[model samples]
Target: MRMPAAKKVKSLPPADVEAIFARFHEIEPEPKGELDYVNAFTLLVAVVLSAQATDAGVNKATKRLFQLAPSPAAMAALGVEGIEAEIKTIGLFRNKAKNVFALSQQLLERHGGEVPADRGSLEALPGVGRKTANVVLNIWFKQPTIAVDTHLFRVGNRTGLAVADNPLAVEQILLKVVPERFMLHAHHWLILHGRYICKARRPECWRCPIREWCRYEPKTPAPNGA
Candidate 1:
C-alpha cells in the first residue's frame, strides 16, 4: 500500500532540504543499516533475502546459513534444497532459495567466486535487481549510490523530500538535492527515520529531529500519560 493522497506534501525548499540532512547528520554522524552481514557475499545474500521480509527476520534465518556457507562455492554446494531448509523461516523461501543458489553458482562461474564490484555484473545474478546491486555497491564498495526501498518511497513523497511517483525518480531527486557530504549515509538515515520516528502509519512528528523541514502536516501527538 502507498501513503494516502491527503498526506502528500509539496517539495521542500532547497535550504530546507539541506537543513533536513544537516539535522540528520547532527543527530547521527554515522548512520548504519540494520541488516547484519559479514562479507560482501553475505551482504548480497542478505539483501536478496530481505526483498519482502524484515531485516531481523532475514538475519535470524541467515545466522546459521551464512556460517554454513560463507562463500559462493560453499553456498553453491549447499544446493537449492539445503538453502531452502535453512531459510524456510522467511517469506518466499522456496523462490529465494533458488535465487540464492543460482546467484552463488553464477558468482563462482562468472566472477571467480567473488561478488562483482560493478552494477552490470551484480545485476546479472539471479534475483539481483538494481536496488540490490546498488546496496551492495554502496555499502560494500563505498559508492555514493542510493538504494530506494519502501521506507524511502514513503518518506520521500510524504515529507516532500523527493516527491516522486516511483523509487528511481525519488532516488534521482535525492541524489541531486542531497549534499555530497551526506550521500554516503543518506539512504540509511532516511530509511531509519522512516522505520522509527517518521513512520508510515503514525509519524511521531513530536520527536522527529527534522520535522520542522518535513512537509507532512498534522503531526502525530504523543501518547496519553507518561
Candidate 2:
C-alpha cells in the first residue's frame, strides 16, 4: 500500500507566532523538562539514556543507578558491567552502559568531574549528541536552545511554527521565530504540547490550547460521548 505524502507546512506569520507563544507563556510561565535528575551530571546521563526511550523509562532505571552513582567519579567507579546491570531495562542497555562509564571517566579525567557548560565540550562526551547537548545546555545552564525531538519536530511543523526537513533545520527555524522572552521555556512548552495534545497518531485539536493559531488542516474532531 502506498502512503500519502505529508502536506507542505506553511510558516506562521510573526504576529501569529508571537500570539501562540504568548498563550503558552500565560498558561505556564515556567516550564521544565520531565527528566528526573539531581545535578548536571545526572541530567546528562538521563538524557543520554533517553535516546530511543521515554523519559519515564529513563527515570525508572536512573532511580537506582543515580542512587548508587550520582557523580562522574562515582559512575566511573561503577564500571560498564555495573552500569549495564543498573540500566539493563532500557533499550540498547549494553552500549549505553559503556557510554555512561566512558563519559564518566572522560568527565573525571578531562573535565575534573564537571559537566562543561560549552557545547563542544558537552558534545565530546560519549553518547552525547546535538539534542542531548542542547537539553543540558538549556535546562542546566539556562541557555536559550531548542532541542528538536520527535515531539517538537511534529509540533513545530504541524503548527506552522517551523517547517523543516530535519531536527537541525527545525531548531534553527524555531530560534529565529520564537520571541526572546519565551525562548528559554519554548523548548519545554513545545515538547509537552506535542507529547500530550498534538500527538502523532491523533492530535486532540479540540482541546489544544493553541488550536486557533495552528495551521494544520483536517483537525481531529472530539471523539464520541465527549
Top TM-score model: 2
Which 10 successive residues of model 1 have the least lDDT summed? 1-10
100 Cα displacement, candidate 1 (Å): 0.3
Among residues 3 or more apart in sequence or in different chains, the pairs in candidate 2 whose N, CA or C atoms overlap within 3 Å are none
lDDT of 2 at 175: 96
What are the per-residue Cα lDDT tens digits for candidate 2 across 79-165?
999999999999999999999999999999999999999999999999999999999999999999999888898898899998877
* TM-score per candidate, chains pooled: 0.96, 0.97
* Number of the predicted model whose lDDT against the real structure is largest: 2
Query: What's model 2's overall lDDT?
Result: 0.92
Instruction: Give the Cα lDDT of each candidate.
Output: 0.90, 0.92
Let me know the TM-score candidate 2 reaches against the reference structure: 0.97
lDDT per residue (tens digit) for residues 34-112 in model 1: 8889999999999999998999999999999999999999999999999999999999999999999999999988899
Model 1 quality (TM-score): 0.96
